[model samples]
Target: MGCFAFKSKAKNQRAAASGARSPAPTSDGQKSKASSASTPTRSIQELSDERGAQRLRVFDLDELSSATNGFSRALKIGEGGFGSVYRAFFRSAGGGGGGRVVLAVKRLNQRSLQGHKQWLAEVQFLGVLEHPNLVRLVGYCAVDSETSKHRLLVYEFMPNKSLDDHLFNRAHPPLSWRLRLQIMIGAARGLDYLHEGLQEVQVIYRDFKAANVLLDADFKPKLSDFGLAREGPTEGKTHVSTAVVGTHGYAAPDYIETGHLTTKSDVWSFGVVLYEILTGRRSLERSRPAEEQKLLGWVRRHPPESQSFRSIMDPRLGGRYPAAAARQVARLADRCLVKNPKERPAMREVVEELERVLQMEPPTTTAADKDGDRRLPPAKR
Candidate 1:
């Protein structure tokens, strides 16, 4: 069952973050590893079939149960429509030198048919995909029998939670302007890699949103949640005409209307998030006044170059961010949100532009310390 079937009105084209069919469930069996040769070097299926197990550890149901305290509610740290994620610590397969590893375990909801598909997608995709800005799938557990079903994934535990948590939650302090730039750039670079850095395959990250961008101890951003990722059109095909599915606000208009999946669709979502970081507002916030209910419609009224643009800047920044850089970021975001998908800048170009944003010198006031003699250097990327 897919989310958001094609509708008559674009407004009616909203989407769910995850829901898709899959190859009939993979049988419950574990393969012993050969060696560490998995890479995005070959086509997705080729890599998954040949070497995915080499890169992933197969956890027995008993081990995962013990590590997660029998899936105790107290240990759960995150959950969505599909499943709940729990924090756990388990010793490595090599008990002597490996010590205990802190991990995040995601357990699928047995009732959700879509959850099973997503679990398989994560197992196959994350098993082969490796990058500093991507959450590592250390292992997985699958048990499907007549009496019980258990599908779970174990990932390196991210200490800082997600960008969405920090950006919107009041508990955490606001991120420094430089830190914000560094984080988004890392995320965009990850997207760039998915789109263009691979050997022969180009991945379209259909779900690109702050919630999916997790943060580490140092606040570096890593894009997680590969449930909706899809391969780009190949063999001269312009787009992958498939079911429209992704977070409603982040999905591109072209994809929503025509099921035309492409790298540009992810770029469009990245643009929405760019404005989000700058404005500290969600794509759609109904609690806000009618004029500001929709972020894009509201922001168009105040172009980045206009004098009122500063009013839209995240007040949490406390006037510390460079005014010029903010305008430039907004401009880049405008290019990403262009109605025509073809006109949107590629992820590589967007990343290069943001890198330049870091090189820019900040105004004295924005960089000065309380003493007014020293300057805060740009945040380290």
Candidate 2:
């Protein structure tokens, strides 16, 4: 889990001439975060060049620590298997006067397996990724020899917390069916980006659940947490094999059985997310009848076509939602959770399907739009 520094090919020559061995990859077999396409490679002679050293200044640990109050307890916002997340403010590296910028800093706990490797994974994936619904990686921090004792990652702070907090927390108001459907649409868009937008490198997000989907002020979902993601096959390779790593309820059944990961795994997980949105329930519910504890299992046994769909919709919404919209989302979730991953629709299809459903129904926002526009007159020359 220790951090390792990176050196360009040219730097190796000078180091060899100086009788020093090039640093090795971290023990976990994961690549360095700095090796991603976004990092510029420099030669040994270039290390002494102005550009090489200047590039290093993009991350200022001292300033980051200051922003987080030296990673203070009061700043702590959330925690997950990877580590603790703290809220902080980072100044734009461009020397803009320190304006307000909030960030979530996840500092890895020592006990976690693949601790540094996970950091590298997020760095490599998010550094170059740009998408509206995907959480942006503003920057990251590693354990230099001097700072090896601590590891940290920085991300754009989501003003509204994770979807899990709202869905499961009893104190919070039960999310309306309209809002939940919108959240699903937003999450599907994020998944669509990972599956289709990146050329040559297809990514399967290993974790797709309520907690990983954060909400913005407008309640648009931003998918976060690339720690569990894996690069999909290239050039006709059918699949990628890796240890099964994901939450208990969300892992696709086929992936669990074979350890062969594919884009369809994400589709299965999306089904679980959709189910959560529909029911206002967690993927795993122990309080329910023992036979009904597994959300997907329960939903599969009681498919939407069987007239059990009404019971599946969140009771908290008080049946206020349109029936057709509920049926569309239910059918979409059923398609995603099919036992055969091949049968599931791709994320793009899911997005389009949900959008079609939304468009078919009257939008809640349009009521406000209609009311506001009524006060204004038609433009006149």
Candidate 3:
């Protein structure tokens, strides 16, 4: 795959990091090395004035430090390529009389691969794009001065952590078939909004995977980490030619080969996660046997009609899930993973398919239902 084949050497270097943020220049001298590289034709400043009017609050460093217990290890909730995230609680300005809010604070490491530019990109995207499925950005801090330099962001805390925590971590109980389907549908809605919801720009969530999907207390899924998001091609353009930057297994093959990205690329990543939801397996497991390392390739070998398809379903389900629903989802996955980008169904179509799968089983009338707890019945379609 020509994953690194950029139009120029500078572009190649800019796309080097798997999760490189947009190359918008920051106030600090740390301007993006590839600021002039290919990008969506529209400038960031061109975003709607209404969005810009809702400016993010600038927090005092001392207050944030207090909130995070001086960035203590005990409060740390997550760590990734960007930096360390901490769980914190902040009270309203009036002290105890005012309500308290829970938040996740991300402190960017000065030495990390992503720096000021990426930080700015996160603020720019999340600052404006508002959706029920997209994580809310509360505020930010940029301490760029001659003495001390620090970059941090505050977000609404997701008590349930990430989808990856539930799907891949052995400590948690396995997600029920109904819950898994719900989560996938929620994620699809988020992607659909990004692809078509905005009036001025088509936002391509370059990084779409389970790890980036956060779940709330009620198991509602929200898309987080907008550092890799990009504006899609304008009218008459087929794709936005830019550097390839995303997680390994979830990125679309066409994007990897040509650096040409479209909404279809996000669809490909969505398909990978759909399979992960179905099988409870990671998209890329290096330790597995060669044939089984890549979940998509291995699962594709067993078409939904084939008897071997049962072998690919999550063993944890113990055959409790509806077979017809599983088969329908598997077919949708096949459509999303097609080699040609054009062949992949749009996010809207994917949402409709998932909704249809949800309707395949009739409502339950078991004792659980009478008690006001309705559980999905086995596949009878």
Q: Candidate 3 lDDT, tens digit per residue, 161-231? A: 98999889989766777767777887899998888776556688899999999988777889999888877
lDDT preference between candidates 2 and 3, better one: 3
Q: Candidate 3: where are CA atoms >4 Å away?
A: 1-43, 48-50, 53-55, 93-99, 362-381
Quote the lDDT for 335 in model 3: 95
Residue 82 of model 3, lDDT score: 85
Off by over 4 Å in 1: 1-42, 92-99, 361-381
Instruction: List the candidates' TM-scores in order.
Output: 0.85, 0.79, 0.84
Which lDDT values do the candidates have, in the order given? Answer: 0.76, 0.69, 0.76
Report the lDDT tens digits of candidate 1 across residue range 1-381. Answer: 221122212221112112222233321121112112243334455556555657777677677889989989999999997799999979866777978878999988888878866776776667667787888888776665546566788998998899898788989877767777778888998898778766656677899999999987767788999977766665446777778888979999999999888889999999999999999899999999999999999999999879999999999888887789999999999999999999999888998899999767364354422212222223333
1-381: candidate 2 lDDT, tens digit per residue: 112223323332223223212332432222222112244332222222322223322244566689889989999999888889999986666676767778788888868877756765665556545687888776655434432344577787887788898888878766765567667777888888777765434667899989999977666678998877766653445566778889999999999999988889999999888888778878888999987788877777766777777887778776767788877788888898888988999888998888778666564554433432232222111
Order of candidate numbers by TM-score, starting with the best:
1, 3, 2
TM-score of 2: 0.79
TM-score of 1: 0.85
